[model samples]
Target: MPDFSFDRLRRHPDVEAENLFAVDASDRLILDEAAADLAAAGPGEVVVLEDHYGALTLGAAALHGARGIRTHQDGLSGEQALARNAAESGLAEAYRSLPLGEELLAGARVVLLQLPRSLSALDELADAVRRFASPHVRVFAGGRIKHMTIAMNEVLGRHFGELQVSPARQKSRVLIASAPLPVTDAPAWPRVARHDDLAPGLSLTVCAHGAAFAGTTIDIGTRFLLEFLDRMKPDAGSAIDLGCGTGVLAAALARRRPGLRLIATDQSAAAVASARATMEANGVTDRVRVVRDDALGSRPDASAELIVLNPPFHIGSSVHAGIALKLFEDAARVLRPGGELWTVWNTHLGYRPALTRIVGPTHQVARNAKFTVTVSTR
Candidate 1:
């Protein structure tokens, strides 16, 4: 489990009630000396948060008495962690949080950002901040040692203002803006109403804030599954798309069939945000529910009619088959006698045998050059 311990940090004299919320954050102040800088911040200030790189928000909460801050991310885990960090620590109700595509980010004098993993997300944020910030607004951004480079500085400098680095402190540094003015240019990427045509009336519009396997034009494995999913004709009942990045499969399947009550689940806040955005864009916001979850956690109900998954091969940099196997086992526990399960994976991972153990019978609908969509009948 990810550490939720903030027992030590809370004891510090300078930490504010809002700052206490950093407890659940993925930010690592344990090793870094940014704590000194955090101890220095004061009241009613606004800041912008970078994606998964969370020092700024936590720092702002800790030292600055940060108020009215704006934080956005395309990663579902990132946003969830931020919220968890805040809520579990008693700061969530106090801080202002918004997803990437939401409006109402205008009017701020200070912007704190972390360079995003997606260049598109990065560009979009920079452009958005530049448009909204006051002329003399101060833009500060940071990253760990590995990501700080001339290219990063160039990206920051071009979009916001003249950039300068703080003295290296514990393998991390803050990027301070020299001068910044409101950018007059319109954003290069705007949220569109329609993208690819999955069907005549089913135009797919993206949540532009998409990152990783969720956004890069759909995963090959998922596409393969989507193409052949109808062969099984999933029964009517509550269904879940476990690890539903952007909720693509869950949303698509639910839209195709009305009886399937679906919930899309993922641990990433960025993914959750995108899934929500996609849900809104596709006008299925009322039809499907989205959850910030881990491997389906423990299902409250004993039976789910259909469980569809395009299980991930890795999380962050860790690759282990244990979680996927656990999800399959959980599926068996929650599935009714006539329920069904569907999954697609890369060709070589050998998922069918284990899946068969849980669902009773299994077979492939179609095998593309890179993936195979499998159906397991209970």
Candidate 2:
């Protein structure tokens, strides 16, 4: 992957509001010059739409500090990435990410967007933009010049009056846009209670904004985890829901064991926020603490008795298993002796040996047509 972060930081340490929203595979870093420009913007607030890989969200935090919004495609790590960016940038005090796809815009002052990979998503975003944009909204769109396709500008033009491209520098360009017009809102996509028939007492209703794997419904992997969940005999005494994307697993855990204090942690701000909303839908938010911690970065020593996961194998399109391996270590570090670690994974990922190596002992818990679930005891 290209190091967009290093490139931006190297070339433009001097620009203001260098805050950015990114695609799933961005390589952005905080540039000192850009940081200084942000200080010049003073204390003004900015909005970041579609947080892919978390580059723009980090920039916004670096620039505005404590005033940021990150919308994530539905998944767990995207929630976790916001935390990682906040930690590496030392901007935790100034950064907060909203789960992407939720109803947002509580009077946003400015909008910063990284053109999404999908032009269809761009159409959806244009409608989202108009909700917060009046004639007064200042919008800046950033990406590599190659990413700024004509369809991309058409979406912006459809929502805002016009788009003027900034001179290409270091192979990247910015689209400066303003003036809101009457743009037809896209029909809301159906999102709540994916795949299952309505169960009067066991149904889950989510406020879904499409994006992420299974953004529109329950994902197959998640469905496997839910099926494996022994609702009647849920382990208690503190559980950690790893990669709590949209909080489905955490919510199910909460619903199954009302007394459990589950910690919802993921790499994506969207996942964290989704987890929070999922718990809230069940009236169990008070029982869970929604944390924006990377895998368990903020977890105290020996803090959890049960750790649940549907481990992710990649960071964007880059296949790096290091994150999951590191998270296994982190989970073991935070679990009490002999604490249980439960997981459901795609059968081909060769996850068992890794589980055994990390947690000391592993046992096959269950299996379905396409997946195998395991419980590792530390």
Candidate 3:
């Protein structure tokens, strides 16, 4: 452990609160477990994946003397936070951000990963490491103990020949994997699934990359929200899908209303990729534009006529309303006067009041035992 201060790290450009943090025990444990390998590796031979904020990448660079590091973060917010932290720490030259592809992993001898909660995401990451990285690459993946499961080891085992479990420390643990297995088949990401039952005479070809939320399946909340597709302002010419995952809602809207223009946007790289693929698969690419954005951050204020959202309630793993509220505020900013913001949420969250205060007068459109769909005027 060098003198680098994890305490100095901040999760700016992300929803921040007393409970949400930029670094965690798992980050420190991962760096400590890989310190020897990181120090031994040459410059440009280190790669960091799924680093939430700058902990793993910056720690490896500033603390372990690793340089020319390649990093990939699924979330745009995390990527921005890393850049800000790197500049503030005067280590901006140590690492570069890249996509989750061969360029990021090529010839890499050491990899530090912050384990994702999705098994499909882990599988895709492990497969890429084995397929693209150096044969001798050593992967150190860490996560909180409560979020770790035996299934994760199995996912890694499918891509690596050896797996070593480190002793848990401070309720965190790491998995060391080496001996990359030969990949024979095509990459298994951007999975495609078709649904004909969503609505009568309406079928969706949903595509999802591994890290995309809800994978290729339509979540119950989104499905519930889609029930009101006909009820959305019929004369609206354009719409934005805020936090769009897999472009399910966007594709559905495009299919139902052939003349309407659609924009699907999300912060996650995987989600943006998945949404683009989905739009293309559904033959809606001409009418739908998919973008990687942080909650309509790139959209002009008072430009959108209608917006659809299924805002996430969690910031990272903790249940919080800050993220949802932030989305609401952004939606309010983007929607034109008298425009509509239709959203779906968990019934228990009781977001109607927040929606009313942030967007405009809100009214529930529909509610089931589990989810509630609402419409707010802007």
Candidate 4:
């Protein structure tokens, strides 16, 4: 049996909390179920997708001696954590990160996957595999049974002819699929949606990739934040949409203040892509710049005149505040003196105290039953 030690694993570079962990039962189940296929595959033939913090990648390399493993992770934190974990575990060069397309999936055999919760993400992955992978490739997709749905099977079935469900173990189950089916055409993504009710004559085009938060629609927190757009300093030369999911905030800012240069940044590759598309769709591509980065780490200290955020309350699936706090700290570092950080968060998170300590003096902008919007002056 391979050494599957959770005690030795860590979520370094990803948000960590008392209750959050790097590996899960599903990770082990996927690896265990795909052991035979993984062992038989030659170098560069095995592909791993969404391997949280190197568990699937490192485990495959270290335990099964699987080499030249090509892997893809949507989040920057997860990618960084995987690198750190690989180095710490003496498997630094075992796997390389690649985009989810022809290059990553143009393989000879087996794939170990951690099924994404988003059905759209699943559709994208399945489409890519069917379009790129070898005809005989077998995919072992596993997840917690509680998180699985019939839709996942249907999504896989659309691309693969054969599907087999593995017996549940440790509350996890793996879906094995093979025989790639040909598709006449690939589906269009970065789907667009229009928000006409935000403001009179202010119909906005929102775009989103499958993995983007809230998809193409504006979430309540963001919609609430947008209500106060008129309150932002008009003359501010540059503004940042920190943790921008689909560039909605940045696009709105650009649309409202054509003179302002807006930076839209998020850690998720999918989010960044969606944000860029949103900017383009809304005719703000020239004014809004979309980037994939860890919080505001890519910006220079004291560089931004204004930063707006609708921070996430969770790290992966866990309801933890570490991620929001980290973003708050980054916003603090990036905002200039006299600049402002406008934030919207779940009211229960009670981020005002942390905002005061991290950014500067804070004042409540708006609050309702669910969310609180606060502005912190630096």
Candidate 5:
């Protein structure tokens, strides 16, 4: 093994804190378990999925002499972190980033995956591998033991004929699967569903790719926030759906105000794809533009008149307020003076003070049993 250093990895462009880390034991264990396959594989044979940083891809390249790695990361932040780490480590040429499709999986012989928490995501990835990757491909999927469940094995088994469980090391474990099953059915991802009861006389068709948050269903926080949609700045010519997952809010807004220009943006590639599909399903494609961005990073400062948000309270599995606070600061920077930021969050998060400090003059809009909706004006 080469003397490669995982310690050099950092979660830049994502939330960084004492508890959050770019690399984890699961990453190390995945690399360790897949070392022989990576070393024996030919060029363009290794693929990494949902790598939190460049750890797995870089580790395979630097430590095992693997080359031509193709990787897919759902979060734009993760992709950015991996790119930065790859460049800094001088392994930028070893791998290329691609979407989760046939181009990324075709002819792949070895796949190292940091198992996603969502079974739907794993199912989609496994199905893609079965349908597109080489028949001899071996998938080494690992995650923290606490997050891994028996259902993950069941999900992978649906696509692969063989499944092997590795012994736990450092509270992490890897599941080895091979022998891709024949795929006869059409791809099941980007699932669509109709919600007629979001509001009276308001029906929404939500579409979600496998990795999208809430997955074709509306979360309580967003549902609470939507209650006050009519009360939003009525005269505002344009509006933004910050962190718009599935574009539910943006579609509703576009329907409510036919003349208002709308933008729906999220960092997750899956979310962006799903939101675009949702917008199209609702016949709002021309009125609402979907973008994959990191917390309105592409928006100009003081450019937005109204923004609707249901910011995530957790970064990865670790519950942290940093991600929400980062969005708050970005929303503040993007909102013009007197612009409104309507937000809904868990009652326990207590984001009012932060909103007041970051945006300005935060006022409670509504409160349900578990959620609190607030409108902050800049």
Candidate 6:
């Protein structure tokens, strides 16, 4: 058996800091417990979900000799890191990335799951497993004990008949669930909700995939940013909703100023799908374009006159600013000279300095007890 080590893992193109890590004890625990079954499985029988890097997938392939593993990661950065780590470890052929749907779970007998913190995300995963995975599939869902909750067990219970929880080891635990139950109800994903008071004379229909932040409801930060929509230059030709979660900013912009061409982009596949659904529900599909990308990586530089952002302050449970700063740089690159970048962030983050340094001159547009909205010129 080959020795699997986390030292080989990397978070390339993502903000890497000393406090952050690519792999943790939970990955090792899951791989160790499932090593026997995985080693006995044939090609394509194993599936991995939400792998932070390539720890579980590559460990199963390299150390346990599992073959033809399929995997799904919601974040583009996670997918990119997995590929890079696999290549560096010479395990590139061990697994393949697929969307979180039937294709990824079809016929999978053993699923290695890194438990998501969101119950809605867990519901979506459980639904797919019950509907698509093999009848006897065993799901090994594990996470840090601090992040695990009783609600997660309930979510899995809805899909699997037997649930066995492992005693905590190294501050991590695994839930072993088997015996798929029949679920005839339609999936609860892409949830739709109406917000009547988001703005005056405006009712925004928000569509959210299971993993999307602030699902089907507007966040206070965004609601604050909405206050300044009318303040943007009237003649700005085009705009972008950088890091658009559910296309709230983009849809609102389109609705407020009818003829504006708005593009919404996010790295999460779920976010892109949700944003598109939101646009259609709001009847702005023709004006708002949704794309899954890593911080405007797919968009041309200096092509837009205005951009809006509500950047995420965390990365995989760690309160890190790498993701937020990356978005700021992206916004700076995408905005034309003298273009405006509107942003909302937590006041404690003190992102104003970064905005000034990265985007150009920055000024406070609005602030409340907890949030601050700023406008930066490119």
lDDT of residue 125 for candidate 1: 62
Residue lDDT tens for model 3, 183-218: 799988889999987966788999998999999889
Q: What is the Å distance of residue 343 in model 1 from its true position? A: 1.5
> Which pairs clash inside model 5?
338-378
Which residue pairs collide, candidate 6?
Answer: none
Candidate 6 residue lDDT tens string, 146-176: 9999999999999999999988899999999
Candidate models: Cα lDDT each:
0.61, 0.61, 0.94, 0.88, 0.94, 0.90
Instruction: Score candidate 2 by lDDT.
Output: 0.61
Compose the digit string of candidate 1's lDDT tens values, residues 315-339.
3333667657767876777777777
Kindly provide the TM-score of model 2 when superposed on the true structure, using C-alpha atoms.
0.66
Q: Which stretches of candidate 4 lie over 4 Å from their true place?
A: 1-6
TM-score of each: 0.68, 0.66, 0.98, 0.96, 0.98, 0.97
* RMSD of candidates 1 onward, in order: 6.9, 7.7, 1.3, 1.9, 1.2, 1.4
Per-residue CA lDDT of model 2 for 145-232, tens digit only, reads 6666877788788778866776666667667677777755554432455334422245565534333334535667777777655532
Clashes within 3 Å, all models in order: 13, 25, 0, 0, 1, 0
**Cand. 6 TM to true fold:** 0.97
TM-score result, candidate 3? 0.98
Q: Which regions in candidate 3 have their CA more than 4 angstroms from the true location?
A: 1-4
